[model samples]
Target: MNRTNSSKSIRLLNYIEEKGNKLPHPVTIFILFTFIVIVLSHILYVMGTSVTFEGVNNETMETEMLTVEAVSLLVPEGIAYMFSNVVSNFTSFVALGPVLVAMLGVGVAEKSGYISALMTNTVTKAPKRFVTPIVVLMGVLSNVAASVGYVVLVPLGAIIFLGFNRHPLAGLSAAFAGVAGGYSANLVLGTNDPLLSGISTEAAKILDAGYVVNPTDNWFYMFASTFLIVILGTLITDKLIEPKLGKFVPTEPMGNQNNEVSAIEKKGLFWANISILLTILAIAILVVPENGPLRGEGGSIITSPFMSSIIFLMMVIFLIPGVVYGVVTKTVKNDKDIANLMTSSLETMAGFIVLIFFAAQFVALFNYTNLGTIIAVKGADLLQAIQLDGVLLLVALIIITTIINIFIAADSAKWAIMAPVFVPMFMQMGIAPEVTQVAYRIGDASTNIVSPLMPFFPLVVAFAQRYGKQNGVGTVISLMLPYSIMFLVCWTIFFVIWYLLGIPVGPGTNLNY
Candidate 1:
């Protein structure tokens, strides 16, 4: 009977693997779904079945369209209107701008052997047993530089582990888990924090007259999440991923077996560290005081000069350290070399540029069709009707968000679509928009490791293939399955405990009954 049950389980697992591998590319699926949704929305609009919600007497109310023409299909109108107003949707375009610039700098750093040197030094110095967790933690933290971790650290993890006669895939899994799964849980705020917060703020205003969810609204929670994810990720990598990788047999032999840290690289690291500290100290002097140059008129963190010019701060942080490293390591012999590095980084963004073009169009078309808004309103209404408790509502939201994430992987875009609906609905139910945003972030972030729709998912698979040729999307997904499932479980538990304890999701945001 036991043998039979084991066989049944193996068959079931095989079935799942086959099905998952056969799934369509996420981007292609999204484009198809967008077209279908547009058609359905137009059909419903023409039938005069489309509803719009507005506030009346402190209660939410819906109004139906009277004229079929109001909802009618007007291809020419959509084309002309959407085409002419492309500039209006430029905010979506801006989302990809920083990613491109950051990548350009990172690409140069990678090409010049900065990342390779850094990894070699780090792994050699750290305790052998602790290397996997450390690499994972570093990958998670590297999200501040956008796609840098995905491109640089993940592959390095495999190479470094293989050099140590350990399972390379195990190291790759650990890095991928941190880079993708722990995306939103960074120690410092990244582009995503402000972007998601803006959407949440806009969504909150749909129900409340004056509502603003700060970008750092989930700062405290996410700060804690950084450590939690590291610990959980470390444990899983060591216990689950490493063991599953089986006995270590070198698949790809390393050309440079000498793992010794060179004096030049050591000097570069020290100089880079010093430059980073100096930069932080300079920023501190500017923004730490009430009357400092970087402080705003109101002396608030949000309104402060520091917050206003965070991108510049990021640029300085990366540029200064990178420059120092380049100089000390003799990688930047001339100004042309620095320019070439920046140029190289931008060159790597070609794929991303192509992706953003289609993704931007899809998002614009989606918003123009009013389908996103309609779904949000209707979905919110249905959830409202259930009268589920806060904990249950959160769980439901997480599950829904996770499902949606599988199809729509762009974090900002998904939140932009969801915020208008979920934020207001939760607010009406006495749940804070901040809490809702945090929940959305957690749900959105957790499944990224396993989802093919995620932009970096294919990239990781390609990286894995370098060490394991037979490894494809299926191999990558299967490996990350443990991390994804474990993250969702542990992350949800954290949320439940935080909610039950009535902890603040962010500075002024509370998780309450």
Candidate 2:
């Protein structure tokens, strides 16, 4: 918590950041990787590289030994196929459509100021003694709408702390810890759930053709983790981070820094809550009955129309509340305002769309080569030979993902590369893809606050400097390091225990395949 403990680590992280900065952009990295796969495919093909594994013949429902050979994309037929499938590959990308649709609803909520009002109400109204927990909890929930916490709640945390006569850095760290460190934990499903699950489903199909990984596959564990993160974040902030910074003495009292919610905003927030309740009630009516239309055969919600339509449901959930809030506050006067707000939200996604275009090609080409299956079978054989199955295997993956996350900040890009290899490999070891996906998420989130390569890291540094000129990247990282370490350690342990207990990770997902 002290400067001495973290000062040296900050220097090392800065050096790591420098090296990471020197690397190509994420899009370039994927493009270069695509070329690497192409080259490797040819060489391996020429060298007669292949793996014989016991796999199910999905059509026949029989277990058979299959020889998966390296397919060369450098060949004439390969080139022709690539040219023909390029557009389809991008368009049919599993993660693309669902994420965009979810974002459309999230866009309305954010643009209508509903998300902002909710966060302000949650933080500013908390009792001082309970402020740390409340801020951290709000940060965890803010992920429901995507990146809203970073822009709104983080600075709000600092301002709330300053108003309470506490060190602003401590408050900022707490919020950052929850927003980034608990990135994958949420009571309500976010855009990331479907985005990741879609990718995971594709990866699983490589091994089992009929396998389907739902967006809610990791919901149970993630819901439990929300509370775990709040408790841990609060303790680290109040006990370690805040005390280390000592007391704050404001040179100039921030007079005009208003933290109170205006009367109109409060009214908008009240109606927004009502709207959310009505939406949920409507959905429940369609989903809860024994013979409900949304229910699947045998009244199963997991395999029902409701489950498959989660993205649409999510869109409606946020969109309705957002529109209602905007109407009450006069932010949305008519249909034109709503349409314009949705367009603006899509504007923020232009960069993500570009990234997904390249990433999709990379994944599609990798699958086309059959390299993913070969790698998975070979890796599984090695791990099984070394007796690294079960909990240790999951633990090792979490650590590896944590380290990789520091250098590669984009979660989707990292998962795109990793899932093809790891998901099927673990499936071969009798571990489910849902478990593998959750492991990746935990590792990805734990180091987010400390990773300088994260897009929001510098923005958070700016938030810190607003309170004290001396506050920089090091100051922010130092303040956050304890929370990161504790989250990584405790969360991994919690997952291990959860795994050992044979708890179902989500509605229909067991730890084993």
Candidate 3:
């Protein structure tokens, strides 16, 4: 029965990969997207296409009609902006800095042998039966640390599974699914939450001038989904993914020691934990009190320096532990060794650096020409005109967002353009801005693994190459597609049930205006 099931599953996945391989390279796709944007902008501009939505006055809190027009990329001013902003656009791109900075710290941990030792410790301590679920859970939680999981955990998952005489690809698929497929679900809020919320608030202003969507707007729902993803991810891996892979066969020699904790390594890990605790204590001192230096304006914790500096703090957190481990283990013979480790990590990002140049141009062009905005507004207008309301409308939005996510994977960029359309349109149906935001999150995150355009998709492919030298984009997508579909279906169901119960999506967040 297992072999028969595995054969059928393999055939289906093989078909998926074959179909996916027909698609262009991601870098080429983004480059082609720029041309499409340019042409579409010119055509729309000539047609004088525009949409009118209610806009709120920032000062007076009054609503008025705001006409959104598509500008021509071929226009003189547009040409000037495009040419002049090329360098700055790539340099200032949101994704470039976070991934690069985070990797530097991760590189130190990875290169100094800290990450390997930690992984060994974690695997040895964890019960074998709970490994899949725990890996999925960690992947879900990794959203809080930016791209750390994509760079670290996915590969780690494979190694962990291999140690237990299981097929490593199953572990890779599960981790990727939990990391990318469950990207929106996390116990602690991530950078994406603030970015999406800010856009939602801006869009909500069209309906209620003073309306605000906090970063924690979707916290309740997201927190719940974190567990849902772990469970679903685990079930899919153990039931479907693992069964299909059949057995473990190491294509590469395993270097990890099982349950063998060296005294030096144990001591290094202990002091690393101490450094982390001390840092946390110091941060708490600065942020916990009424007059804390990290507090926001009027003593707000959310908008404070501590919240704003999370990514930097993550880097610091990793750096301290990594350096401590390296020093104690003699992995870092000198300061130059630390520098070399960081550089080596950066070296692995060569393709990403190249890919970003194209992505930056495409994003900049899309923003300047306002094509994404027009499409979003048009979609919302159609739905509003049809009078699609309540649960049905929300479900439709999820499907629409999922389809769009295939070609566009930048969460913030998609939401920024989408919010101005969907938020106000949904508001017309008496749906709250926060609710619309949550629907978007469900769709956007669930489809990430299948999207070739997702930034980390290539990195995942590279990681897989270490295990199977010939594994390509198709293989990764095939392995991850089931999780993507399952997450979307299950998560959307949970969302609907939660909404029907009139549950608050977050603290003081509502489903209705």
Which sections of candidate 2 miss by over 4 Å?
1-6, 251-255
lDDT of 1 at 306: 74
Local distance difference test values of all predictions, in order: 0.71, 0.90, 0.78
| Reference-based lDDT, residue 379, model 1 | 66
**lDDT tens digits by residue: candidate 3, 280-331:** 8888899999889988889887667876665666667777788888999999
Query: How high is each candidate's TM-score?
Result: 0.79, 0.98, 0.76
* Tens-digit lDDT track of model 1 for 25-51: 545655675576567756876676654
The 10-residue segment with the lowest total lDDT in model 1: 64-73
How much is the lDDT of residue 31 in candidate 3? Answer: 76
Residue pairs in clash, model 1: 104-345, 104-346
**Which numbered prediction scores highest in lDDT against the true structure?**
2
CA-only RMSD, every prediction: 5.1, 1.4, 5.0
Which stretches of model 1 miss by more than 4 angstroms? 1-80, 91-116, 162-165, 194-215, 244-246, 251-255, 357-374, 405-434, 452-478, 508-513
| Model 1 error, position 499 (Å) | 3.0
